[model samples]
Target: MEENQLNPDVDYTDMLSICSQALDFYQQHGITELIHAFNIANILGTNQFYAEAAFFYKVAFNMHSKSAGQFPLAHFLLMARLVALLKGNFPIKEDEMNQLKGLCIPLYNFVEGWKRYKENGDALSAIRLMGNCFEEFHTGEEADTIYLTIMMDLFNPNPEICIKDRTFGAADFNVIPNNLFMYWDQNPPAEILQNFEYHKGLTHFNLKIFDKAEAIEWLYQNYGVEARQIFLSARHPAEAADFLRVHVINYYGGWWLDADIKIQSIDKFCSIIPSSYEHVFLLTHNNVVHNDFFGSVPNSPILNDCMLSLYRNSYLHTGLFIAYKTGPGIFGRALNRTFYRSLRGETKKPSVVLLNDRKFWSVIADFETPYKDSTPHWQAS
Candidate 1:
């Protein structure tokens, strides 16, 4: 009969017969039956056919194991073993454990080789293989242990890795002090911090502004008086201001800039210009369109509330401000306490003195704008 003559409403038995014939024809054509069998096993497993699915999955896994190395086949075999164990058909054995351990040795070796190649800048092939490795073997505590071991080995180099390019190093990049102050609570990855510090640039650590009193003390003790000058901020306003005071008292006096404001370049603008107001800079609302960025200061009753109101009216950003040590005083402490209280929802109103009248904070810019090269800067509202 012509193929087009076949009825759409064919009976189940007729469909089964046709499918069986087609499968047999494919098998006779030397097509690998393993893939079909593996697919069938998955379908069966999905349909709760545990015993049948385990048998087919094992068949597929063994076929692959013989052709591919054990590492490449581990995922399929592991799944097969899991399914068998779930069905009570397979049990953990000494021989099976040995096989798994053997597989792991090569996987670790592979990862180490990749890491070495990556360090030497000859990692094209190794980098390509990393994805496969992660996908296949990211399982259980054994994998975790292997990863940790590899990382430890890589990082424990005697000479340590160095960047060949100096421009990307801390020296070339202009590190803003403001950025450092803002990220006071940001703890970057250890590797990142190490790289930055190796270049003698700004590095960061995250601390619970309220709870890290001991850590703060420890840092001071280890790094000495110079380390006390490193800028930091708290997640909450109250905590940040309090932390600032604590450091101020210890360091004698240092500047504290809110994180939200971004400076174009403090080194070029402030460092080069030597004036009596060198210690002080004019802060204006970011949205103020006046030719002078810093025109007038805002005097609001409730500082936080005024900040919120100014933010609402002139659309001025409230977070940008610089606080310098003008002889020891209670103003810093009071601001810190007020900020804390406002954050805790304790105060119905916020008391923010508008430093500038230009309507908005200057730091507001595109998300990807680079605030500083090597220096720490603020990223506030």
Candidate 2:
């Protein structure tokens, strides 16, 4: 029960133990009730076992939908079903699809649009259907974010392939330049510097390291006043770096790794990327596209979308959190827009690839410096 309570420090092993306990408790008590099924689903969802969570949610929904109640518990359960499926990237089954159609027309339409897009790489119908869901469904920001993520996933050209198919040798290279970039606000500590040099030696790529002043000067000279102003307005050094990295990569297409990243092996890293990809990113454990390290070709539409999002989020929500304002949240939104445009034939389908942590860790890792604890985290601030 203690494990079921919220604790950010809970590790994978702890999650497994909690799941085992919950399952055993259910089996021992012969609990086959609707709420019990939903409770198990919640446990699984909390542990990041989304597919299993989705199955149990489905079971709960079937039970709840059959009963009539004054409360909207059935509606809540149905929404959970949608969230679980989207997060897990699992397909909707026929019975579930039929139930969705009967309960909430707007959600059903959006899910059906997702289904169509997933089945065939067309986005026009999906886009059209998606237009009306927000006005009709009226879910809050959190649900909207999930819906947007689902749209992105449905339109992804290669949803499952991360790095395995990208085993191109030294002869082939991406349109993105061989240059590597990293930044620190001021004098980087010894450990970070060591990480910088290590990655440089590993890749043998032309490395461009920047301090705050240098970053500002580069932005001013290359992108003019608007970019320089946005960079200047950043609340944290991390926020400033976040804005600058996108501009740098979008202007001179190449790889951008955080100063703290250390590549494990150059050969393994190089072997995983296909030369044909215009852009590449890694999906974090929570399924959001990681912004800490990624690559792009110059003038990539997706990166451009990110830049636009930064500018808009900066001017509109000046006090917004860093992640949504200039980090992975904006990046994921950009992916959604680019994928939609690609589906509608409005632009060239982005040649983007997304890898998971398994392949990503096989290549590189976050090298924490001694100053990590002393540094001000956004969450702490």
Candidate 3:
């Protein structure tokens, strides 16, 4: 709920006051700008005023859809409207619901498909409906994001579709390397170091910690200068970590744990992934795949997609939210693309396993990160 949202640079606290003033202006003089309407919706949405956000989002959508051709941003606003409606649990009018269902738009079709799934509890149908939307759109950015949002929403109602269990045998462990990696920018506090040592003691894997200098050098050596440059261009240390973790795991074929992450029971943790599994990661109760901790075999297609996402988003969206650019945004979209392709028999389904919250928390307890106050975390950044 504390997500940085579309643009964190906006001061929502000040915008909330401006939003009220604008509403008053609209009521009295009927003054409204298209950009203002969209900004109001974004502020309200980030503040969790979903019902009001939906109103402004609709206004923005209507304005853009009518004023011009089908620009992609207009569709994004439409998607936002549905998300606000869904998140707020606001009742849709019978006439509006009918209108949404009758529209030839792919987004509307997807929303109607979601409604059907809500009624019938058919997970595969909902997935296929989302897949159909993906097939229609060849572009990235907002289109891929719409797919990610829909996929996240679907996981909540049909939890069974998201969980993947991997029970590794003794022989299974031999194939996958026993390397565990974590990174810190520099000057790790004693508390963080203690946590690192504790995890190292618990697991048999060769735990490797990389400082900022070492991380940059490793990226340069393995991924070449372009990768190193991306790491340098990162606005924050954590963002740089996002770029590095995937590359390291993809090349080395092992586990990458965030510096803040602490494993509770090594026995339970080590038991999760089997040798045959190409990818292993944890999914939160909210259905986001955690980039903080994950494992993969060498040259995983999923991680390759993640690396590509980092480069593409860096070039295309210079200042996008880190989650969407280098974090779970790309992670979830890659999974959906892989899964959808698998459904069509276009490619082999990747051997991916997602540990649910129940399974994930059993071997790991959440700890207050030492740099919680000092570092600019994604939500605040």
Candidate 4:
């Protein structure tokens, strides 16, 4: 008889039993499967089968060391460290503590690599881990400051030692000066000064000192191309709204042009597009009710009327926005005030008041503006 002719009826209970047996087998034998067990233990503490989970993690760690060498050590170390920390306040198991201690160098090295590469996300992650470890070790603020300073040096834009090959090129034209650069020449931190010789060897681009118009013209003339200009002006809504208007016009010399925009072409879009309008174009798919993307719009009677209404009602959102600027005018002050009031918690109904207004705003609301999300990006903090 053919095997197909002898087909048996399916049994749900047997199938479930088989699945349970397989899961049990996996739990008993599979080292890779322990990550899930560790995660579960992390979420649900030792009182709820976490001891078993920790045991599984330990087994997985040992298996990883035996099979993959030190490749998986960082992950296992982090997991074990978290478990040890959580189960603490008393003396931990000596072997477990030693294992956690062993992870410190590798973790620190990983963080150092991130800082050197200016990987903002990784740097932040490393900082978080360092902070946890510091707390566990009761490390003093002085040690923390040293660690932070070291990390900052790894990512500093203006190091004293500028290697010729490492100098800023045309591609790095948009790199903005950070607090590190501003303080480097004045009260050079010891960490930065140590690498000053290396920074000096690298070429530098001084955007603030260079003639921007000439630079733009030169790039166009020599390279047969035009570069987009982006002016990042960040401030408290009360102060920055006024400053952004002057900055944009001064940088671009009051030229308006329509250009193709892509999702990734934010700087390019902002440069070619005119800011003198009620609705400034954005290089994002997200909608905005106000032009907060450019910081502030030109002042106008319409905006003045809206400002008057908001002031009379004592309403604000303290949200920054891109504004519509047709010519030299200060029409968006009310919107700025609105945002300032909202931020100060002076406005009772922030979201409804600022975002619901349709007369003075556009599709983009003040809250809808896309601010920089990266750690190294511009911010007052």
Candidate 5:
């Protein structure tokens, strides 16, 4: 497993196959106490096979929760909670919830109390509990870093949607969002805009290319003072982009694309939108959800849920602030939760259309990450 992480040449498919076999062996032989499932989840997650990895993480986490102290365990269960949040397994079974509630025993209650805070809309107590989680599982600098990151996000969410339910619905346009919205912090070379202009969808009004100022204003109005300060003071403007990305889709409706996502692919489909039943257009690469290129009409319930789930996870899984609090991990978790809930008869309409990567991500652009330290990706995609 260390080799896989160190070596750049590892084949993810083969790694997953090996891990799956190990899981089978562990299950059949009843080597419960000795079993560790993080390796499997790690491999799958790295390769973008998040949904499957989430399923495994959930089972392993539950098993670990029920085990005696002899079971394989990490000093901090941050990763476990992260993948679980990404899985979006909400409204968990009564027994599962109980196990989670009791895990942070003696120090203080964990999930159970967090759930109460969420229900009551009490941010202060919730953040306090999250800080306690950091102290409980980590120490020294690691604990300090974890606590600070969660507190920053909690203090300044940089809310995405400034205006809700502005205009457009299925009746107004084939898709509720009437235009294609892609984000770029700096102005793109003329060519990108050219592609956008030429390939504009017939049903839409205009292509709105958002930059840092627009994103900042929208989020500031929606999320308020602390969020505005964070966006302005962020090391890189892109760190605040995901905050804006969620708000754009939630408020205006339409697609969001990484600058690297080719314009032609989305433009080609401009003539057509997903059927009325489909609420979102997402794609999975290597069996994991990849939203490098994705779309939603307007005011999608799952997008709101995804935003909410992120805060819910802040206290429990904020160790990897960039990945868990603000990356596709939570987005995938929210999306997975939406689909799972729908399967259980919680939602009526069909949600998410998984697309083909070969079609959308062809000719992958060579682009450098705008921000290296935080990897605050998709803040404005």
Candidate 6:
């Protein structure tokens, strides 16, 4: 297995091999090799290897359980508990939630709100409480200095959740930037083909479909060695997607549509929403915008900052890095920092249009998780 790039969608055999290697290191060196196992587990979970994530979380916890209450390990332990919730391990095996007895406001609200959501389907309530906590302790960093994911999944609140003054029609241009364009052989995953068919009908799109090789070449030729290295170093397909998606936009400057978008309604969404803002366009019903689908002009500051933040946070193994750095979370954070900085006269104002939700969305992950049928914890409205 490669040092990076663990998640492969076509099959998990490769990842399973990598996990075994990580486990080997732990077995050979004992607790000193804990972080390797922990980081690999995180990579597996991000790629939806829930069963593996559960197993590794247990292993890591056992290795460092004694030090869990100490300074840095506590934070990781709390996060481990949260991740356990994602894969169906509930009411957490331990009696305590996190090791930090002296809690911070955001951390307290986050843990409590998550419990509420888990107990009853209260996503909005949990989100609202978290939002309030953030407002109470707003830290305006270029990146989302405060990183948290209710789950590694993106929380693009359904459009019906809130009314908006403006909505979207068709985007200025048709473009689709995604991973694994030709990575698969003749037989790809059924889900991959389904997503492709859903949007390929929109023939006019400037589709920039890519596989691992194509993406690496594009990065090397266009952006340079560093970007290619970053893309190649990702521990999973999603991580590669996370890194490459931003680079494609930063270099080409166009709409980045998920393969699962319903292409049939693109024109209507674009036409109805008049072009009021130019450089970048984002949509949302909730305060936090999602990365499912968004557009930006070439080389915009938003995409640039996003790329930079991803590079800076590459070392972090937390869910926040997966969410913000390699996921849709960074896009909004970068935009917020740019906009807020302009407000404070720190930078020039960017021409960005914020539209009502449903401008573009991928229903595959819209409001669902693996535990959808067995539980009622995260039902969509």
TM per candidate:
0.21, 0.65, 0.77, 0.22, 0.49, 0.50
lDDT of 4 by residue, 1-381 (tens): 011111224222332233444345444643234454344334333333334434445544544533335544545434453353334322235555455456665444433433433435444445434543322221121222233333333232221211223243355112212111111113333443434433234333121211234434433453333121211122223222223233332233221111110112323223333322332222222122223233223333234434343322222322322122111112233333333344346763221111122222222222221222422322342
lDDT of every predicted structure (CA atoms): 0.34, 0.71, 0.68, 0.31, 0.49, 0.52
lDDT of 2 by residue, 1-381 (tens): 121222334233433344785566456543356776678777788777787677666666666645557233665667677667766777666776677778777767767766666667566666677654543322122344444545555554354453454435564435778888999989888998788778767647888989999999999999899889989988888899889999999988988988877766766766765556788887765567778888898888889888887888888777777877788777777776676676667897677777766666776776667888888886443
Residue-wise C-alpha lDDT for candidate 1, range 163-218, written one tens digit per residue: 22323233421221222222233544454344334323322222122124543564
Ranking by lDDT: 2, 3, 6, 5, 1, 4
User: How far is 149's C-alpha from truth in model 1 (Å)?
Assistant: 61
Model 6, 1-381: lDDT tens digits are: 122222223343444665665455444544344575577566666666666665565555555645535433644544554545544544453344544224344655655666676667565566555443432222222113222233212232332332233445776533323211222212335565666664566554555567778788888998899878877777656667777788877777666655433344545544543334444344454435556566666677877877766776675533343665566656656765565466456786666555444643422234222333443321111
* Span of 10 residues, lowest total lDDT, candidate 5: 1-10
- Candidate 2 Cα misplacement greater than 4 A, ranges: 1-128, 131-174
Of 1 and 3, the candidate ahead on TM-score is 3
Q: What is residue 353's positional error in candidate 5, in angstroms?
A: 1.6
Best by TM-score: 3
lDDT (Cα, tens digit) per residue for candidate 3, span 277-344: 56776777756788887788888877787777778888887688788778877787677777667678
> Over 4 Å off in model 1, which ranges?
1-183, 189-215, 218-238, 258-262, 271-274, 278-281, 284-381
Instruction: Give the per-residue lDDT of model 5 (tens digit) for 25-63.
Output: 434543233144555655555555655565446545544
Instruction: Give the backbone clash total of model 4.
Output: 48
Error of 1 at 360 (Å): 10
Report how far off residue 132 is in candidate 2 (Å). 8.7
Q: List residue ranges in candidate 5 displaced over 4 A.
A: 1-174, 186-205, 226-238, 265-267, 271-278, 313-321, 362-381
